[model samples]
Target: MASAPQQSLPLFYNDLQPLSSQQHADFKIRSADKAPFLAKQHAVPVTVEEFPLVQRFMPIVFSQGEEPVPLALMGLNEGINTFFDEDGSLNEPNFYVPAYIRRYPYLLARLRPDSDELSLCFDPTTDTVGAFEEGEALFVNGEPSETTKNILQFNEQFEQAGARTGQFMKELKELDLLIDGEVTIQPDGAAQPFVYRGFMMIDENKLNELRGDQLRKIVQNGMLPLIYAHLFSLGLMRDIFGRQLRQGKMPEPQLVQPTA
Candidate 1:
């Protein structure tokens, strides 16, 4: 999918690829489907359920280890029960089904925060933006379900998984290149349903759809190779005394109080 030219937002403090500090502040890129696809952060389970509606059929469990089967199985039409639990003490078997994770390795996105006691549950393939509590489950008969505070807040799966949504995420982290990083669609009268390649804008209006997830696809697909460079502050600087001077800090500066 080709991304249109859009106005990029000013850098946010958290997403600027934070420096690795005292384990309190550190960042690394995880593959959504690649190693660097996800920003660095610890994830844990806030909720785990047996989603029967998620699978196609009840399959046999082939295992020797005494592990509880995964509560969430991929490609299964039958749904599973989801237990909402969070505490450092919770074990993988307490929340996760070994069978499910085995079938779908990327099913869960775990994260732990130093300030919170709860783990966040996320369906990496279909989880919506913001908190997972607000999102809904994937339905067997049709599409995935999610709750939204506003209609405006939603992940619209366009283009028939023109890239299988799950497959895309898994491969992105591993692949070195995309056939074309960006694309352009003229929508000519001569041809119908034309798909373009590479990051060329179809029009300016499409830029309104820009979101964090889309940004990742664009970057992985080759639209923005050096997109990282634009995310840092040109003026914000850290001082010798652990002071952050927001205004442009240069090697030479003015001493207002007259240095001794």
Candidate 2:
């Protein structure tokens, strides 16, 4: 069967051109400075492979609505990312950058709906990636260079990680573990707590209710720790809100959900 319609292109990719010798034989990708591309993004898609590392720094939450994919929350509100400075440079000296951000400009995508194959494509809009005299060559003498080879390998790994992430989400959905995630934080001296909603998270009550066999399967699949990591990472939502407050990017008051 034809694969599900492609997920919306990740943030920043405007157009995709299959990497080819015929079209881009001399196209070179210049290494740019820091990631200004991520400055406006508050969240980015993440995969299971990097969850362990990413959960250490950012809250790994699922997207709201059907077909929930894992995401690393960079900020509590939209249009604000706590990870970057005003100039769009990373503020944290030693934070682990997600592979999604690292694999920018270049991505593996399906060019045709009926085909299962993923084509290696890049964004032509990025100034760092184009036909240029300087920097790394995508093709060397009509053959993919070592740089291109390495990127292919990385993107391949990313695709595999994406597959595993799909399975993880499938298992969570089958077991009915996902629930609407809500949190209320009382900013220092604020009269009312800021209620945040519209995100999905693993429900602890549902998780605790799993049967022995079901629990065993989840444990054997090694999803238990990842679930806990997600739970633990929710605490950082407060920290992210604080970061936005300190940076003067605090959002306006949101409608509060009634207290239980």
Q: After superposition, how far is residue 160 of candidate 1 from its true place, in Å?
A: 34
Q: Model 1 — which ten-residue stretch has the worst lDDT?
A: 233-242
Q: How far does residue 65 in candidate 2 sit from its true spot (Å)?
A: 1.2
For residues 1-260, write the lDDT of model 2, one tens digit per residue: 22223457667777667788878888888876677777877888888878788888888888876788888888877778899865679998868888888888889888887898988888777888778879899898899999999999999999999899899999999999999888888876888788888788999999999999999999999999889888998888888888888889887756222110
C-alpha lDDT score of every prediction, in listed order: 0.22, 0.82
Model 2 root mean square deviation, Cα atoms: 4.3
Q: Which stretches of candidate 1 lie over 4 Å from their true place?
A: 1-21, 34-48, 57-62, 65-260
TM-score of 1: 0.16
Cα TM-score per model: 0.16, 0.92
In candidate 1, what are the lDDT values of residues 150-254, reduced to their tens digit?
A: 111211121122224334323433332212112222223524332212111112233234567766767676434222211121111111111111211212222
